[model samples]
Target: MTKPIEVRNPRTGKFDYVIIPQSPKLLSQQCHRLRRGQIQWQELGIDGRIEALQQWKQALLSERDQLTEALINDTGRLSTSLLEIDSFFSTLDRWCHLAPQLLQDTAKNTSVPFIALQQTAVPYPLVGVISPWNFPLLLSTIDAIPALLAGCAVIVKPSELTPRFVAPLMTALNTIPHLREVLSFVEGAGQTGANLIECVDLICFTGSVETGRQVAVTAANNFIPAFLELGGKDPAIVLESADIDLATSAILWGSVVNTGQSCLSIERIYVAESIFADFYHQLVAKAHKLQLAYPALENGEIGPIISEKQAAIIRDHLQDAIAKGAVIHCGGKVEELSGGWWCRPTVITEVDHSMKVMTEETFGPIMPVMPFSTVEEAVDLANDSIYGLSAAVFAESAELALEVASQLDAGAISINDAGLTAIMHEGEKNAFKFSGLGGSRMGADGIKRFLRKKAYLIKTNASKDPWWFNEGESSKDI
Candidate 1:
């Protein structure tokens, strides 16, 4: 049975107004069942999984405003920010269309040194997901679907602030009765998330690098391998080269989208020497054009920072950036909103790699742009972080852009694109380095990450590999 818990909607400055379900144990057991392989995703096939995801997608669309509002209340995100729903749809629709084919295994001749053989990577089951509140519905559900379709079950837990969104989620699951039993939600603080780490077979986490470190430590201690989609200090490198318009849009949307709460949002902008002043001017101008207020429960441009604590943390980072001599180009202070969580959209310039804003995940509506001279310098500047989640380059030449992409330490890079992450691309997922561990795009990566490989050997020549079994008798018998 699920029990209701009164939770605060920090954005609206309200408490006990919204009730969330807390089912930590039941959620744990469902995950245990998935680990035991009682679930059958193979039977569902790609089409079936696709259909189910579509249903969920439709449900999200139907409840988009409510979900957005809840997230805004929780995070102080802007109303217009939920526009990530576009990318969310892109990812889900694409997954429904492509995950099965992409995730399917390829049989191959092993061509082992001594004998005729076959080799293939098989899909394993069940991935546990721990989602944060920034883009609550999309990240939570998209990460869950691929695993389920890969013949794995999922146990998902959203960050506490937006837990209220799950009620509508439960309603969406009504059509997929089988999944309703396997796909579960448990709402609480870090304890609930930590408990899930022990319960599931594998994990997929998207949140702060600090918390991600704790999860990693625990998972590592248990020898429980999992994926971490942690944090980002992604940079946008603009060469005097290219399309000013394209570069500007990329940087603006990439960094400030969702009020700069996005992991791959352009945390840093490196403009070419020639265009630095122009780009900075245009960028700041665009920042001013943005309509900022408390996020409307539905269509507002942005929302709150999830909680006062997160807002405070973001504030601290901003203050530190200012102290370090970084320029605050736009909205810098916390704003009081009526019935919603809110933060002013922010922009920063004159930041270097050493500043906290450039190193840590501020996760607020803030952007810090820097400038560099050459392609070589740009690459060095972009790769100078502990984070390698995602990066982008804006240059006229495709060859140079690809070259820069090859050199950067990041797991994913966008050519001629700014902060607009391609996470929902037809056959991909968010890339990572310090951002997270072990993930890929399309269908192969995420679900596959949860899978483990066990190589099987058959000896027709009667030679035991000497690892365990006798060469002739044991090999022949088997």
Candidate 2:
């Protein structure tokens, strides 16, 4: 028997829950069952799949309270948990709405008069999704729902660090027997995730760059497709003509929301030299207003650092930045309050690419701001990192913002606002550099990634043409 893994409550920093990963034999059996069920699941067709998913959504809605509570316990935050639940529901609805149209088969006449083309796609039999702990429910299903809608059976393995939500989610899943046969949630750590890659036809992973690379390699060994959304050191550039108040507010929320524990978080900030002091001052003031959600999860805006390991990274980044002569205007340290690890929204200036906080994936509510004399310099600084997941650009006019955004190396860039990708899913974008690889997990590609396309080339007439072997003439004709 596998030993159970302990889970910590982010709010308390205590290991209060345990999850036992299924045995390798059991996991393989479950994969077999899901693969067998996938035939019927795919046969149900897109419309039928949509109906089953909608029913599952209803079942999940009934278990909403329990699921919400589990998520709150898992992540040690209230409002964000609620938002995660909402986002999961929205994702389900969005995929259900988009799948039918996106999955439709098409027939077209070819340039050759006697030929016609029929295009269609078949779903990958089984898809394995390994999601992160930051937004447990949302990230876990972000790929699963679309894959399910595309007629693929899905098995999700969420982070063992936050596995509490799996029970209620499974309960909801079980209510729809048809869906249950095709969709499952497995609880385990890295080994489980690696094992899952061997059992599925495709794998979708949302996590760190280090782990993502491992998943990619394992999936390659298994000869399966791997779609990864990895780490980010997303940067936000504030132009001189930008509104300091607007830029600061948007950048603050983008950098620190979810305690900056997101792949899309704007960790590095580059501002026009003219507004450098004012920008940092406004950012610090806003950072000070946010409080830790300690004792009570509702006490404040900032939540406890969700992972203890992540908390240590946050502390190390802060220490490195301070040691490197970065000036911390507010919230410089990670504090242990009532056994929970919390850091107030920290705003630092006098920072450069040399500091870990500026270049590394801090994954904390720490923002390092630097000044650039020219727009070109700002763009260069923002593009200096190994990560190019996403970024943002702020300017007085829409045209200027778009122009600046066009020069960035990141996948998704928000103009005038920040973290729009968190809410907006209609745009199709691919991660650049070490951020990630594979197709877009947004827009039409989300569901399409689960499918393999096939084309039927038809001859409109019965007569054999010039392209044939010409049996009668053969060598003599040549």
Top candidate by lDDT: 2
Q: What stretches of model 2 exceed 4 Å from their correct place?
A: 474-478
Tens-place lDDT digits, model 1, residues 349-408:
888877888877777777788888888898888878888888888788989788778898
Each candidate's clash count: 31, 0
**Backbone clashes, candidate 2:** 0
TM-scores, one per candidate: 0.83, 0.98
Query: 131-224 in candidate 2: lDDT tens per residue?
Result: 9999998999999999988888999999998899999988888888789999998988899998888889999999988999999999888888
| Best by the TM-score measure | 2
